[model samples]
Target: MSRLWSPHIESMKREQIEEMQTELLKKQLNYVYHRAPFYQKLYKKSGVKPDDVKNINDLQKLPLTKTGDLQAEMKETGDEYSGRLCVPESELLAVYGPNQHPMPENPLITGITDSDRNTIIQHLARNLIMSGIYSGDTIQSLCWAWEPFNRVYMAANLLISPSVSEILGITPVTLEIIPLEAPRTFATARLLKPSLIIADIGHLTQLAAICQQNNISPEEIGYKTIILKEQRILSEKETKEVSEKWKAKVHNMLAVQDNMLYAEDCNIHNGLHIWEDAFIPEIVDEETGEKVGEGEAGKLAITNLFAKGNPMIRYLINITAKIEKTPCNCGRTHSRLKPQ
Candidate 1:
């Protein structure tokens, strides 16, 4: 049977998904327009108000926010957050940026309130469950530690590891993957005998080579699943090669760093299912900024519907992908993104 963290939301009907998205989008737009100076200026300049967006379809009326726009705003205003921060400095719980260590001059800093952090954790838990994590399963995470560089990567340790341990009764072994620490990592893996491994393809590739050199087999390690922290789609050959080498089910996890968005592949491995309830995704033509048809490849744009701090509206993420609205074999009703 398919594992689900929030079955009702994950398997909701298309109509119900749309209704929830519409309600959340309207509230998010209103919240950003009134509280965030950057969004307020952008909407007023485009002659569109929050009320103009009556539903999800009406979101096209608002202008798109690009990375360049955010940079320009930061350059002009000298604000690190580019005026996208809705919460005050005191209310900010966590702040993330593009680099490992964000400087004061960084243009794209995202701050999250306590509520926003909880929302991220909730969705992240659902994604882990869908990726075949079960209670009592031990997870060995090779992602980065809880640092300022990438919140999603850090979530693998700080948020996901603890949450899964406390709530789902899973044991987590998180290790920061440094080149010199390869021996240590493998030694710990052998000792712990974790059921699942979470790491990027590069790390896995290196580990695989090391295993071969040491006359060790991945199958002997007894990990049943390997979750790849991938930003782009992997070719069929690559996926097959990795799965064969590791003798484990390989799952792709697409993490959009800018918006803190995550989409994970289920057991079927057809595509990465996006958590649409928290994010509004639009596949639009890069040149004309027009919406693309179903299953048509275009730039992936996302709007944060549940984030209370640094909410993004129609932010073009600069990734080409085709959005699939059909139901997944795993019974999830959320749309999937086949990233190109």
Candidate 2:
């Protein structure tokens, strides 16, 4: 049986979801247009008024925001914010960049306001729920080196490293900085017997190989699910191999560096159901900048609805996807995307 974190919103009608998006988007556009010079310039150049975007369809008239635009802004203006700051600098609770690597001077930044932080936490909790993680389940996060994954476990107690005491007490471990090797990871898993393992596909593949070599069955380790945390799609061979080798269900989640977890696979494993309430997703043609047919593959464009401080309107995520509006058997009415 498929479990839902927020059944009401997850099963909300497509039309209703669009209605909510349109309402919030209008306010967001108006707010950014007046406060942020970056958006104001884009709006003025495109000859599109904030009020002109009345519905989701009208969003097509607006130009897509690219990473280069922000880069150029920072280079030209010497502003770390790239002119995307809707609220004052004092109001920002946190800031995020695109990767875990050490950034050069004046890198692109995504500011998080109090509202944005709250929304992110709420949505992240929901994503975990969809992944079948409950409050007491022992989770070992294997997403080593990623900084955003560290903040994703606010509700659940994430252990920095494996602890026999914590595992015996049924508490989870969140591995952020651990090395993705066999000896330490498998040793900890053998000791702690985690219920869920959060790692990308590559790490999981390595772990599975090590388990095979060490004559350790992943099922024997007591993990029920594996949440893959990177952008790449899982092949059928890899999925089956991991499922059989690890003896766990595999879920592919779609996330961005700045936005964190936005979409994830449910128990049904049809496609990654977008957190529509968090961001407005669009499948637009890369060159023409037009919306594609339903279920047709196109570039993924995201408008982070809850990002009030650093409004990302019509931002192209540089990933291709095919969106489906038809509700999945799992009960979520939000559109699903097969991101490539």
Candidate 3:
């Protein structure tokens, strides 16, 4: 069997997470300063040396690497858009250049050619496996993989791998991934009748309706549990109808492209266990870029400590969530995240 993080840096406690991030953050900055010429030039012009980024508090000194900056780099330079690439072109595993932009000098530069994004996923996947999810079970999704949101794909890879790690409870690590798209009723009935369905209730409703129209029994689909993505609002009628139809309990998980899904505890209605072990979370005022107090809702900015392929430090994700005050009843001291 393989392993998650060798010694496993995936499921470290909150305290350990902070200490580890602090160290990695420093190394990341130093790396960018030395390797990425673009960032090195910026540092020279700003009179802000990379060493000046002493800690998370001083991160503000480094200008936020916005999409526009990335664009400017791609337009100006060729394959080496962010001359601040710490790893060499050969070492760069993948780049996640959103389709919103024009074609890069080289397509690969924009994609995660290096393992930076992979490293981040390893941390999150290990956490997901440890949180819940056994090897014997199966996972299904309506989402696409490796294109837009590679996190889901990365997660699937982590689960299906046979590895030994303290991060995830999955020792043997063998699972199946069934990607479901439109005309899903026919597709699912024919193929992925999985035990675990990772989609929202609305998605489930759509699936059920499709199945009913096709004359397939809902039970035949076999969804023992469903991972619910947080909804904007819930109607009483909708809630009641959902409860009676499926035999599974719905779990609302907090996930976003910018902020990887995590919470304060394994089970907390409001707070999502923050993956501090990989993602360094900061709740700041939307306009002012100032930190908000605990239990307050503010803009969410995440610094992926492990992402070397494509690193984002304090990149504004445009989410406002509150930090839960009390430690989760689940008995972990790590802080939790709840949407504002």
TM-score of each: 0.91, 0.88, 0.71
Ranking by TM-score: 1, 2, 3
Residue lDDT tens for model 1, 225-307: 98887667666677778799889988887766558687888888888888989998899976566798877888988988988
For model 3, state the Cα shift of residue 142 in Å. Answer: 3.7
Off by over 4 Å in 3: 1-15, 41-46, 76-84, 99-110, 113-118, 148-180, 184-192, 200-205, 215-220, 228-247, 252-265
lDDT of 2 by residue, 1-340 (tens): 3677578888888889998998888888888889999988888998988888889889998999888888898898888889999888998766767664567666778777767756666666666778777656667765544454554334233522222223223355556434446456677888887778777776766676777888977678778998777765555576677788777888876767564445777888878888888788889987777898877888988887777778888888778888878988978888787844
lDDT of 2: 0.74
Measured with C-alpha atoms, the lDDT of residue 170 in candidate 3 is 30
RMSD of candidate 3 to the truth, in angstroms, is 6.0
- Point out where model 2 deviates above 4 Å: 100-106, 144-146, 152-170, 177-183, 209-215
lDDT of each: 0.78, 0.74, 0.53
Please state the error at residue 318 of candidate 3 in Å: 1.6
Sliding window of 10 residues with minimal summed lDDT for model 2 = 159-168
Error of 2 at 124 (Å): 2.0
Residue 196's lDDT within candidate 2 is 81
Model 3, span 33-134: residue lDDT tens? 776677777678768876887776777676555555655666677644455456656774434543323554433234343244445455445444433566
Question: What is the full ranking by lDDT, best candidate first?
Answer: 1, 2, 3
Q: Which of 2 and 3 is ahead in lDDT?
A: 2
Candidate 2: clashing pairs of residues: 159-174
